[model samples]
Target: MNIYKHTILLLFINFLGFKTFSYATFSIIAIDLHTNESGAALGTCYTKQFKIYTTKLNINLADYVVLENNGFGIMNLQSDINDFTPIWLSTAKGILAQDEPYYTAKVISKFLTQPNQDYKHKDRQILLLKKDKYNNITSEIYHGENVTNFKAGKIRLHIDDRFSIATAGNYMTNTHAPEIMEKAFIAAEGNLSDKLIAALNSIGLTNDLGDSRCRTSEGVSANYAFLRTFQNGKIKLDLNITTDEEEQEATSLLKEKYEFLQE
Candidate 1:
């Protein structure tokens, strides 16, 4: 991320008071070696009812999922949703510094593990991804000990070792959600965007209330969703969609938007 973008993001975070545990989402990050495109797709059950101190501010939960360096890497920060700007900044710095993904995750873990922090690391779930020039994608996922049930991550590599996919979720209806998403991504045909959308759709198939919290609204999977992809330092596609109304299925709305874009 650049300084200008970073400034805007910081302002947005502060403006919305984004330090809350209302984000219950499932996400997938992947790279397409054939197209040199990297992308992330995610959905959350967040709605107006989930708003905290930022009730008056217009908020987009997608902003919390960091897409840095023009999709060269992505980091999903969930569970506590506290202001981990420092952690994200560190990860961005590590990417810019050309550090390995493992090393960057290690550095961030140090801070997350530190005691007396505003939030406990045991309640946080984070997923990190980095794609090198060779199209080799590295992924790291951390599911805190205290995260709710059905929280887990799965990583899959292409047979040729040219691409990789990573999926993670928390507070889900079942533990098989991540695996289902991975399978959908692999089976789907098209560009990176199509595969990502497929993975997101799988969430709805796995369970009507994929996030479980949506049981209150009887909404399936998510209420807000986003899919973004970049190639060669340029944005290839960016889609952010929310349900027409609360208690609606966001993944369905996302699919509609994605289909329109394809046309």
Candidate 2:
């Protein structure tokens, strides 16, 4: 019986991952479904393997519209080196909801890498097989409990569009992984106490976390992506959090405040 259930879950994941967009230089109209009053046209060009998503947004969604164009100029830059390869590295957007249809739609049509005219897209995606609407929902993604620490009086929720990225914030379909870090404190503790979240949300770490390119075991402070633990006697606001060492007190203080672990 357990095996049957597990198989079902895996099959379900097949229904909510990625999408296939046409390889063409075209424009897509993004109408804020929430607010019909505003809309924008995104300029994009797609090749067999690479895609470049672009747009001009004059009005911003007050609280981020799902699948909205985020206006990123260089998810893939058309460099002379990449002239013909069919692979895409795109900006994903959206929140992960375990109960709701929680996946980002494919809205890109550009290429950043080498264009492969003979690139044959044979992989079938059941998630995007629906007529038009995206039906794939997200399963709660926990990297690991040891990877994070939560504070008291504040609930920390961690989510990721691992298999399929969403279009929710910054127009990049893939979310700022560090963003949830900020929201964790804001939603639960009702505070941005310091710029801890803001500093983390900045890019580079977005792809650098865990990736050796961002950090090395030899230098923990030099690397940007980290969720390490700290120790503190007093809960002092981190008015100046520039390095991991500097962030130590603040993280220690937050963990102490929440009492997530006893050490």
Scored by lDDT, model 2 comes in at 0.20
Candidate 2: minimum summed lDDT over ten consecutive residues — where?
123-132
Clashes of 2: 34
Tens-place lDDT digits, model 1, residues 28-144: 888777776778888776645444333344445555564556545666666666555555555454553353444444455454455454356687777776655444566678888
Tens digits of per-residue lDDT for model 2 on 1-263? Answer: 12233334323323433122221111111111221111111111112121121112111111111122222110111101111221121122111111123232222221111124212222100011000133232211111112212111111222232111111111122333334433432333212222233233322223332112112332211211112111121212211111233212222333333333323
The CA lDDT of each predicted structure is 0.68, 0.20
Candidate 1, residue 116: lDDT? 50
- lDDT of model 2 at position 1: 12
The Cα RMSD of model 2 versus the native structure comes to: 19.3
Candidate 2 wrong stretches, greater than 4 Å: 1-104, 107-209, 221-263
TM-score of 1: 0.80
